[model samples]
Target: MHLTLALASAALIATINANPSYYVKPIEDENDYARVLELSLLFYEAQRSGKLPQNNRIPWRGDSALDDRGLNGEDLSGGYYDAGDFVKFGFTMASATTLLAWGAISWPEAYIAAGQLDELRKAIKWATDYFIKCHVSEYVFYGQVGEFFLDHTFWGRPEELNTTRPAYKIDPEHPGSDLAGETAAALAATSIVFRNHDPEYSDKCLKHAKELYKFANRYRGLYNEAIPGAALYYESTDYGDELAWAALWLFKATNNTMYFEEAEHHYQHFHLKERPNEFFYNKKVAGVQMLLAQITGQLEYQKAARAFCDFSVRQQKRTPKGLLYIDKFGTLCHAANVAFVCLQAADSHGIGDPQEYRQFAEQQIHYMLGGSGRSYVIGWGRNPPKQPHHVASSCPDRPAPCGWSELDKNAPNPQILYGALVSGPDEADKFHDRREDYVYTEVTVEYNGGFTSALAGLLQLRVKSIT
Candidate 1:
C-alpha cells in the first residue's frame, strides 16, 4: 500500500476497532457502517463497463466496450461487469440493483446521514440507464453482453480489452422469464428511489418495468434456455421466484391492485410460501414472503419470514469464525444476502424477535468486516484480501502492459478495490488470498449488493432514522 494511504487507513480503521460493539453485543456504531456504505458505492463505480463519466471515481477505469451492440445494432453498453471478469450479465446485475434499491428505500435516513445518498442513487441509475438501452422493445431485452468463456480466457485491464464481445438477447420465440422479471423488479424498485429525485426518470423506469413484467408473464421460460451461453455461467434454477418477486416490486412501486393480486397468484402457482434455504440472484422466495409480511401484514407471509430467519439464526451452518457458510463458492455473498433479507424482516413492523434477527444479522456482517481474525472485504480492516481474483484491479496503472503474467504477482493488487467483498472463507474459516484461487478470492457486483445493503440497514440501527 502507498505510505500515505496506509497511514490514513490505519487511523480510520482504529476508530472502527475501538468501538466497544466490535467485540460485545451490538451497539450504535454509525461511523463504521457509514464508512463501509460509502466504500460500497465506490466499488460499483469501479465495475462500470461502458463510456466513462467525467466524475468517475475509479482512476484506473476508462471508456471501454463502447462498441458493444446487439445483432440488430441495438446499443448494449453502460451496465456493470458481472464480476471480476468483464462480462455484463443482466440477470445478476439487475438482481444486485433490486437489492441495492430495496436497501436505499428501506434506510434512506442512514444513507442521508452518511452523505452517500447522491452517490448511491447515481450508482443505481447507472444500471437503470443501461437497462433502458438493453430493453430494445416490449418483448426483446439483452440478457447478457460478452460470452463468459471467451471473456474469462483473457486477463488484463478492461480498458485494454480487445476480445470479441457478442451481445445476447431474448425475445418472443426465446423467452427468459427469470431475466426479464428480475430486470423488471430492478426497474420498478428503482423507480421508487428516483420518484422524488427525478420524476421523469422514475416514470421511464416504471414504463419499462410494466412492459418487461408483461413480457415475462406472457412468454415464460428460463433465461439460460434462451441464451445457452449464459447457461454455462449464470444459469437460472427457476423463474417462478422472479415472477413473483417482480410482481411484488411493481406492486410496491406502483401501488396497483393488479400487481398485488398477480404477486399472490404467482406465489401460489410457484409454491413460494415455504422457507427458502438461501437467497441470491436465482432464489427470492424468502424476500417475497418478507415483503408480503411487511406490505400486507398477512399471517402466512409473516410466519414464513419468521421461520426462514429463525433457521438462519439457529440452524444455518456456520464457519468456525461465525460466518454463515451457505455455499463453497461466494460464501460471504450468500451469507450477506441472507443477512440483508433477515434485516428486512427485522425492520418490518411487528415482526417479533427483531432483536434476535438484527443481532444475527450484525454478527454475520461483522464476520465479513473482520469480527473474525481476517477481513473478507478488500481494502478494509487488518490484513484484508489483497490479491483478489480480479482483472482490472490486478493490473498496474496505464502505459504499463498488463497480462496473464501480472496474475502471478506475489503482492497486493496495485489498485485497491475499496469496499469490495470477496467470495470468502471456507467452513473452517480458511481463506487463501491468492489470485488464481478464484473460488475464494474473486469479487463480484452480486457479492457487494446485499453486503452493502446490510451495512445500510445496520447503520440505521446505529443511528436515528429520518422523522
Candidate 2:
C-alpha cells in the first residue's frame, strides 16, 4: 500500500510538471504583475470593509480610552493589536513591489496605472509625506513604546504611593523594543513600495531596509540553533519561530547576491535533515519554507515545500458536525498558511494536483465567512487541542528551563481570523462562510498607506506584462 501511495504521489507530481502555472518565475511579465495586484486589491478592500477583524487592541475597563493600568497609554501595549493595520502596510509594500517590476517590463501599462502620469505624481507625493510621518524612530517594537506595562499599569504610575510617575524608560538602543522579523518585513515591503512609486522616498526606505537586513545578517549563524532553521526573531533580543519571510522578500526585492546567498544558506540548513512529518506542529514556518522554495526554484526546496504541504493537508481537523476546522497556533491558521502554500506551489509547479490545496483553501475561506459573506468573529479554537510548540525551549549545550519549548504543548492555538488571507481572488464563491467562531471586542487602526500607494505601480507592471 505504501509503494502504491508513493507511485500515486509521483504521478500527481508529474501532472504538476505538465501544467504551465506550476513553474515559478520572477515577476518578469505583465500577467504575473496583474495577478499580484489583483490579490493586493482584494486584500485591501477586505480591510476597508472590516471583513477582517482587528483584534490587536487594548480595551479599557471603563468607557474612557485611558485606564489606570498602562493599558490605556499608547506605549503599554505592543503594536501587534491591529490586524488590519499590519495587512495594510504589508499589502502596500507587496503591491508596490509588483508595480515597480511591472514598470521595468511594460512601461505603457505602468504609465496608465500611474493615472496618466500627473495623478501618479500626486500619489507619489502623498506616499512620501505619509512615510515620513509614519517613521517612528529607527525601529518598530512589538508593543507601543512607553505606553503601558504588560499587566496594564501605566509606565510610571506608583500603585503604593498613589502618585503619577514616568510610565517607563525607553532603551536608546532598543527604543522601539519589539523590533522583530515581521517589523523588518514590513519595512522591507515598504521600501520596495517606495522604490517603485516615489523615488523621493526610495533612499529613506533603502536605508532602513539595509539596516534591518544587516540586523538579520548578524544572527544568520543562530538560525540553525532554532527549529526549521533560519527563522527570524520577533525581536533582536529573542527568537520565536524560524521565520525566513524577511529573507525571502529581501532577496526578491534586492536580488543582491548577499541576500540571496544568505537566504539559500538558511533554507538549505533548515531543511537539510528535516522530515516532512516534523512540520505538522508548526505550519506557519512550514508554509514559509514552501514560499521560499517557490521563490528560489531549487529542487530540494521544492521537495521540502511539497512535503510540508502534504503534511499540513493530512493534519487538517474535521469537525464532527461536518465542518472542517483548521488548528490555530498562536494567531496562525490553516487557511492563510495553506492558501499561501498552494498559491506559491501553483505559481511554482503550475496547477497539477492542486485540487487538494484549492479545496482546503476554499474550506478555510468558508469557515471564516460563517456560511456566507456576512461578517463574523472567529475565535482561536472551538475545539482546542494540545499541539507541539514550534519555538525552541533552550540552546544546544545549555538548555533553559523556561525558554521557548521546541514544541509548545501549552501554547494557545495561534488562530488569527482577521485579514489573514494574503492571496487569491476576492470572491465569495463557496469559500465565504459567515459563522461565529470567535469574538474580539476591541479594534485598532494602523495604516501602511504609503505601501498601498506604491502598489499602484505594481498593478501597472502587471498590465504591461500581459499585454
Candidate 3:
C-alpha cells in the first residue's frame, strides 16, 4: 500500500508541475501553506461575477452576468457565484465576505508577507460593492437573483446564460433577519478592513451595517421565507446566531458600547453559548464565542471557546489520516472551518492549551495540503483536482462555448481552476476528480472562506515579520 501511494504521489506531482497554466510558484519558502494562501485568492478571482477589470488574473473568465440587477433595475452586477452553480445567494455570499474580511483583519501581516494584501482587499470590495447596490432601499435588500431549478437545468458558462433571472428581496412585510444580520456583519467587518486604506468607503460600509442591523432587529423572520426559492438551497435555521454575530462585528469595528451590549443581549437571548458542531456559512456559535472572548476577555466566553476547540481536537471523529470528518459532503471544508475557529480561540485567550490547538490546526491544514496523499485544492500540490464541479473553470476558454456536452465529457477541465477548494472525501477520506460527481468534486465560495482564513492564520504564526 505504501509503495502504491508513493507512486501515485509522484505521478500527481509530475502532473501539477507539467501544467504551466496552473503553476503558481511559492514566494521564497516552498512551504505549501504560503502557496495555499495565494491560490485561495485565485479561487475568489475565479468565482468573480460581473465586469472583468483590466487587472483580472483569470484569463478564461470574462465579463459575465452583466445584466444582473435588482427589481427596480438597480445595478447588482458585482459579487460572486455562490458555488459550483451560477446563483448569487445573498446569505451565503455575505457569510463568505464576513469570513474573508475577518481573516484580512485578523492577519494583515500574513497577507502582506504573502503579497496578497491587495488581492484580498479587491476580493472583499467586489462583494461589498454589490451589497451596496443590493441595499436599494433602507428597508428592502435583494436576497437572491437566480432560480435554482432553472439554473441547475442549464450547464454552461455563466457568460452564455440566456434566461430570465428574476430578483427577490426582503422588506418590512417580508423581513429576513438572518440575511440582513449576516450582511450587516459582512459590511461592518469590511469596514474595518478598509478603515486605513479608504476611510470614506469604510464609513459607507459602517452606515449600511448599522442600518441593516437595525432592520434585522426590528423585523425578525427566517431569510428563506422572504425569498422562498432560497429554501431549496440555503434555508437558514436560525437568525439568533447572525444577530449576535453582526452585533459583535459592529462592536469590533466601532468600539461602541451599544453594539457590544446588543451583542451580549443576542448572545444570551439566542443561547449562543452552546458550542456548535461546525462553523460554515450557516452556524456561527463557535465564531461568536471566539470573538466574544477577544472583545470582552470574559472567562465565560473564553471557556466556551476552549470547550469548542477541545471537542474538535480530542473528541471529533477523524479519517485514518487524521483529517477531521464532520460531514459526508465538504468534509475538508468542515474540518478547515473548525481549524480556523479553533485557531481564533487559541489566539484570543490562554484557553485550551494554545500550543495544542495550534498543532491541531497545522495538522488539519496540512491534511488538506498533501497529508491525505492527495491535494483537495484544485491546481496545486500532488494530484490536485483537475476536474472540479465548477461551471466557469469547467468551460473551455473563449469562443469554444461550453454546454451540457462539456459536462458529459470524460476529461480534465480545459481551464485550470487555480486555488479553488473542491468538495472533499467521504467518511473514509476517499475523493475523486470527476466533474459529474458534485458530491466529491464541487467547489464553492464558502469552502474557500474558512480554508483561506486558516491558511492566513498559520502563515502569520510561521512568518511573523515580513521583510
Candidate 4:
C-alpha cells in the first residue's frame, strides 16, 4: 500500500508538471500586451461605429450586448437591460477598476488597449470621474454623482430615495450604515489610478484611503478600543471582505509596512478562524484570503488558500446527466469564483492533479456557455431541480442558498469569470444531491472585484514564473 501510494503521488506530480493548463498565465506580459492592443482597437472601432460610446455610460442599446456569446447567437434580447452603469459603486463597475489596475500592473498591454497614450489617459480620467461620482459625504447623503445611489447602509436600509436628508443615522451598531465597503473600494480604485496617471490626485486619494483604513480599523479590528469584540458581527462591522482588498491595494500603492501589517493582522484575526472550510461559499472572502496569503507568503495564509481550493473542488456539483457544475453555494454554476480559486491553486501550488482543477473549470465554462448560453447570468441560486428561494432583499423572509447567481444580479459572476481555465470531470451531479437547503446569499460587487483581482494577481505571478 505504501508503494502504491508513493507511485500515485509521483504520477500526480508528473501530471502537474507536464500540464501547463494546471498553471494559467496572468494577463500581464508581452503576449497579453498584444492582446490588449487588439482588444483596444476593437473597442475603438466599436466606439466609432456607435457600439461603444466615449463616456463611461455603457452603451446598452443597439448591439450594446457585452456578452459576445449572447451577441453572436442573437440571444441578447432578454435578461436585464439598462444603460451601461458600470460607473456605479457597489456594482461590477467598481470591480472593473480593480481589474484595470491589475491589468495596468501585470498586463501593461491593457494600457495600449486604449489604442494610444492619450486615449489611455482619457480612459483613466473617465473611470476616475465615475468613481468620484459614487462617493458619499456622510451617511444618508444624496447626490446624482453616479448611476447608483450612494446613501443607505450596506445591509439595506433608509427605505427612501432622492431625499437630501441623512437616510440612516451613523451608529456603532450599524457600521455598515453607509457604503463603507464601497467607499473603501472607491478609494482603492482612485488611489491606483492616481498612482499611475494623475500625480495631482495622489494626496487626495491617500487622504481618503487613510480614512477608509481608519474606519475599518476603528470598528472591525479585534483589539480595537472603539469597538471591542465587534469583529464577530461581520454583517454590520465596518470591515469585511472588501476592506481586506482595500488594504492590499493600499499597501501595494503606498508600500507602507503598516498597511501590510494591518492587512495581515485582520486576516489573522477575522478570516483565519474559519480556516480551510471557510471558502465553501464566500468567494469574496476566499479571494481576499488568497491575495493575503500570496502577498505575505504566510504559512497560515497558504494553508487557507489550499483549503479554499480543495473545498471548491470538493463542492463541485455533478449532474445526473454526467455534467459537472462548478456553481457556488446557490446558483447555476458560474465561472468567476471557481475560475479564480482554481487558477490561483494551479498557478501558486501547481494543483498536483492538474486534470481535476482544469477539467472542472472547462466543464463550468461549457455549461455556462452551452447550457445557459449568453443567458449565463451568474449570481446565487440552487442547482437545477432545486427550488430557488427569494433571497434578493436584505431582509429576506428566509435565507437563500449558496452560489454566485443568487447573491446579487448586478455584480459580476466572479465565481466563474475572472480566472477561468477549463480542465476536470463533469461534476454537475453533486449539486443536486446536497441535503442542506438553507443558504445565506450575500453578493456584492466589491467582493466580486476582490475575488477576480486576486485571481489576476495569481495569474500574474504564474506568468512571471513561466516566462
Candidate closest to the true structure, highest lDDT: 1
The window of 10 residues in a row where model 1 has the poorest summed lDDT is: 20-29
TM-score of each: 0.93, 0.46, 0.93, 0.50
lDDT of 4: 0.38
lDDT of 1 at 98: 96
Candidate 2 root-mean-square deviation in Å: 17.0
Per-residue lDDT tens digits of candidate 2, residues 1-467?
Answer: 32342344345335433541232222223222222222322222222211112421111101111222222243221112122122112222222332222233223344344233332333232322333333333432122212212222321111111223222211233332112333344445455555656655656755655554455445332221321111221112222222355565566567776765665675566553253332211222553566566665667667767766565566645443223334321122323334444534544573335667655544443443233222222211122111211111111222223222422233432222221221111222222121112211112121112112223333333454555
Instruction: Supply the global lDDT for candidate 2.
Output: 0.33
Where is the poorest 10-residue window by lDDT in model 4? 78-87
- The models' CA-based lDDT, in order, is 0.87, 0.33, 0.85, 0.38
**What TM-score does candidate 4 reach?**
0.50
* Model 3, C-alpha of 142: deviation from truth (Å): 0.6
**lDDT tens digits by residue: candidate 1, 1-467:** 12332344345445433541221112234237876777788789889989988977677788989989989898887999988889999998999999999999999877876777888899999999999999998899998999887886899889888889998899999999999999999999999999999999999999999999999999999999889988777779899999999999999999998999999999999999887889998898888988889999988888898999999889999887788888998899999999899899887876658889989889998888778866777776667898999999889877988999888998888887878999988899999999989988988899999998999898888665433
Model 4 bad stretches (over 4 Å): 1-174, 177-179, 201-203, 219-240, 271-283, 318-334, 349-362, 371-467
Write model 3 residue lDDT over 1-467, tens digit each, in one string. 32342344345435554653645432233345656777788789888889989967677777888998887898888889988788889898898889999999998877776667887899899999989899998999998988888888888888888877778999999999999999999999999999999999999999999999999999999889989999877778999999999999999999999999998999999999997778887798898989998887889988998889999999999988899988877788899989988888768756778889989999988877777787787777778888888777778767787888888788988888888888798888788778899999988888888889999898888675333
Quote the positional error of residue 312 for candidate 1 in Å.
0.6
Candidate 3 lDDT (Cα, whole model)? 0.85
